[model samples]
Target: MTVLSVDDIRSRVDADFDRILDVLSKKIALASISAHGITGEHMKRSAEFVAAELAKVGIDAQVVQSHNPDGTPGAWEVIGSHIVDPNAPTVLLYAHHDVQPVPDKAAWDTDPFVATTIGDRLYGRGSADDGGGIAIHCGALHALGDALSVNIKVFIEGEEEMGSASFIPFIESHRDDFDSDVIIVADSGNWSAQIPSLTTSLRGNTGVDVTVRSLTHPVHSGQYGGPILDSNTLAAMLISSLYDENGDLAVPGIAADEPVGGLQQDVDEAGVRADAGVVDGYELAGTGSLAARLWTKPSLTVIGFDAHPVDGSFNVISPETRFRLSLRTAPSQRPEEAQAALADFLRARAPFGAEVEVEPTDNGMGWAMDPNAEATRDALEAMREAFGVEPINQGQGGSIPFIPELQRIFPSAQVLVTGPEDPKANAHSPNESISLYGLKHNIITEALLLAKLGK
Candidate 1:
């Protein structure tokens, strides 16, 4: 096959922009949200849609099925492959088809299930997280056409938003099919919409549900609110113990890694305040820049609480209260170790002899890449040429459990994490969207990287 010039690939991607948006629109129209106690039928249909898209670009694709741990139905994983030569290195392209639930319908400017374009951004649920990822893979492959230099395999996951709990088992069962010399995960975000970024590190995570029981039944608060330790008060104390007076993560075993080669994140204080919707007298937590605290440090948040409903709140002291704790662990820390420490700390510090039960829900390890590898260098150059800007190396605070798992499966492979999500993309939140410029540039970037590595 003749080598396509970088400009040629860029032009090809540009020429196919309309078709790309159409593909993205079709994907966004499906409500493929994956969560506990919900059917993944939409995700299965999404897998089929992706497989059909891959087929249009001369790739043979199939939807593979797996089951949840409890024999519940699972999303269908799509696998597509096109080999140029047997001796050439294979590049595995990874993305997910599932997305997070749309929490509030009233918060969106348009229908969350429909792709609506405003200015340069395309708004919709799953538009940026992995749906954009799917478009990138297909667009790059379509542009390459038959002139492709490297063997390519696509693995679009079906349950990423739900922690990818069944992903390892799926990989083990199809280990031979995933053999490759390099893996490119296209589910991460860029540093900014205009600037290209290569994610170099990801924080690990663990979540637990804690329930505090203080009484056999609810009683009138006026009578027992003082002497009896209600579950609400006890749960509040248990939650407060996880933080220090200065508002840092007070867990014993977790600590931040030294900054990545003294590299600081590009975010600023004003941006953080504005993006977080901070109120007038609110001060930031932790020392160092917001980037340091976000990308390299551990943090804790009370994701959800199961106390008395606000509408039906009576003058009663509830007997039991449940809350879910999400703990983001340092990249250098093992999530299981941190989780155990948290459980031990909570159990030992039960306030007023309250019965505390801390049950771990999920644990995923963190990952760091060797930035000096040859493939890494080639990718930086390819992205610079494709995006017309010097690519920044960034770290993500979110955990992708599949990254660490892929590292374990293919220890020698070069792993590149690149995607189209920008700062305002708001992935996993209301009104998630992707910049059209970011999408076009990332597709070109991936195509160029494949061209350079394929030979």
Candidate 2:
């Protein structure tokens, strides 16, 4: 088999992307939102869809599932493989088929499930997060055709949006199938639409639920509002204490710092504001380089609150209130420690001595990858050659607990996290999209890497 140049691979991928776009669009149309207590039918269909696509590239594929720790069945996952030579290195291409729920339908300018191409972006849910990733794997395999050298396997997860609780079980059940020499996790984002990035770090996370009680039972606000504060008001006070005057997370024992030597870089402030959709006259929270604040900071957010509903409410001093806090820890900190510190912080700072009870709801470890590995250099070189620009070593602010577990399970395999998501990708939010040029570059780079590995 003849090895192809990066330019040759780029030209082939650029020419072949029209078909790949159709593939991604169709996948995006299926609202495969994996969550707790939902029917797994959509997940099953999504897994089947991925399997069928893998089969089109000469990969023998199947839809598989496993049991969670509590014995509940897990969401469907698509696993497939195409073996050209048993002696060559095996590369596992990873992506997820699940997407976050569309919280508000009216907020969207276009249908979230319909892949509408506006300008150069393919607008739809899951288009950038993992659908583009799926396309990259499929498109690269399609572009390479019969010139394959390394064996390829695809792991399309179905429960990533819901925290992949069953990933360990699935891998334990199918250890041999998952064992590979290299793993490319394509669920991360690039530095920008025009710049490629290798995700080198991810912040760990945990959730804590704090319940504050002001009274034993409800009371009329008009009659009892003078001296006593409502539980909801008390909850607000507790939440406010999590941040400092500079808007940095004020939690103790968790501190934000700069990304290590090779990954240090600053992001455009205006671009970040626009991507985050900050309303007029709002400034970003936190201090220091934008990348450091985002990639390595500890962030505290009041994700869910149990208070009086605004719709049909009567004037009343609520007796009790509950809120869930999502704590994103620093990249190098242990989540268990973060969880402990958060619980302690809440317990100690009960505003006005409101009876507060804190419980640790969930936790997942963070991860940092080595920048000096041979496979890392190879992937970076492949990106530079394909995109004709220096690639950035970046870090993601999101958490993929399954990633650390994957490394623990396959300690010898080099994990390379790269993807098509950019700041403007708007992943997990309305108006989500992927840049066409970025998508094309990734497909070409992966094809080049596979070709190099195949040799």
Candidate 3:
């Protein structure tokens, strides 16, 4: 079988870039933010729209409903398969349609739901995170069409932003339906604008909420100022013990190791501090390599705290205080085991005579890919051909929560994590945007990958 000309396919991809972005922008405007991720009606709609578009291009597309054990709305997985020969190896292209909620609309420069283009970037919620990635995949498939010889299977789930609670089960039950020898997860970003990268590992995550209780009610600060067991004080102490002076996690069980992967370009610490609104003298926790601290080691972050403020404070032994802790574990760490270890650490370290309760929430395993696999090599060649640059390998500090499950289901499959977004894309932050230049390159890259793998 002859492969499609790279220049021809790339030209087609470049021509469709604007139209693809328009489709993605319209989808983002529909408010498919999962409502606490309980129901997936909005996600289903987005999946249906993508399926319809693929069908218009003569691709056989369908929505594979993977329900929860209790028959609730689990995850809507969109499958677009085009297989000329059943004996050919299938390639699964993965992305997620669901996005996090835009609760802080006031912080955004433009309407969070509206896709606004400022200069060369498209700004909106989910515009760069996974939406743009999905757009690139669909656009590539549209451009390639019958030129692709290998079976192309596209799977876009609706529950990735969540913990992907139903993903593993669905894959386990219907393994044959989603079986593939190579999988492309277009959900990560490059290390920098010009430096292309493939995510080689993802840190697992576990969340815990701790509550400290002292007295039954608030007492007068003036009367009980001395020897009062303030819940706030206890909570602060507990949270502080989570990290040492050197900024390494003090918790046990979670493993830390020097990064085995290549490091990304160093970010300016001062700039990061300024953007984060940290005090002048404040420094980020930990030492050694910043990328090592983030991608290969465990980190404990106090995400939120609930306590009385000065305005309303009676300053008594404040009845109770609550705080949430997010723990990022190394790729080799088990999330459930790490969660237990963290819970035990908190329980043993709590102050005496204070009622402390620790509750674990949203624990998900991390993922690590075999970087030397044939599929990854092909992907690198494809990226190089499209972008004129060899891709770098890096580990993402964030957790995808489903990649490990996918790995388990397809033990022999090769997983490739590459996408169009850059580090400065502001994903999950205000003014989230995607670069048109990156998008075009990624569309060509995806198309080239299909042709290369088919050959």
TM per candidate comes to 0.89, 0.89, 0.89
Which window of ten consecutive residues has the lowest lDDT sum in model 2?
255-264
Q: List per-candidate RMSD values in Å.
A: 2.9, 2.9, 2.8
lDDT score of residue 47 within candidate 2: 87
Per residue, candidate 2 scores C-alpha lDDT tens digits across 1-455 of 86777767777887888889999999998888886332378888888999998899878999988678788887798888988888999999999988888989898989999999999899999999889999999999988888878898888988888777888988998987899999999889787787788898888898898899989999999999978899998998988898889998887877565674354467778877876678999888878888888777888888999976799999999989998989888877888888998888889999888899998887888887878877788888888887888887788787888888888899999888998798788888889999998999889888888877665
Q: Which model, 1 or 3, shows the larger lDDT?
A: 1
- Model 1 has an lDDT value of 0.86
Using lDDT, rank the candidates from best to worst: 1, 2, 3
Kindly report which residue stretches of model 1 are placed more than 4 angstroms away from their true locations once superposed.
34-42, 70-72, 102-106, 211-231, 306-322, 350-357
For candidate 2, the TM-score is 0.89
lDDT of 3 by residue, 27-89 (tens): 788667755553656777877887886776656889877777676767777777777788887
With a 3 Å backbone cut-off (N, CA, C), the pairs that clash in candidate 1 are: none
Query: Which 10-residue window of candidate 1 scores lowest in summed lDDT?
Result: 258-267
Error of 2 at 55 (Å): 2.2
Model 3 quality (TM-score):
0.89
Which segments of candidate 3 are over 4 A away from where they belong? 36-43, 104-107, 111-114, 213-228, 267-271, 274-279, 352-355
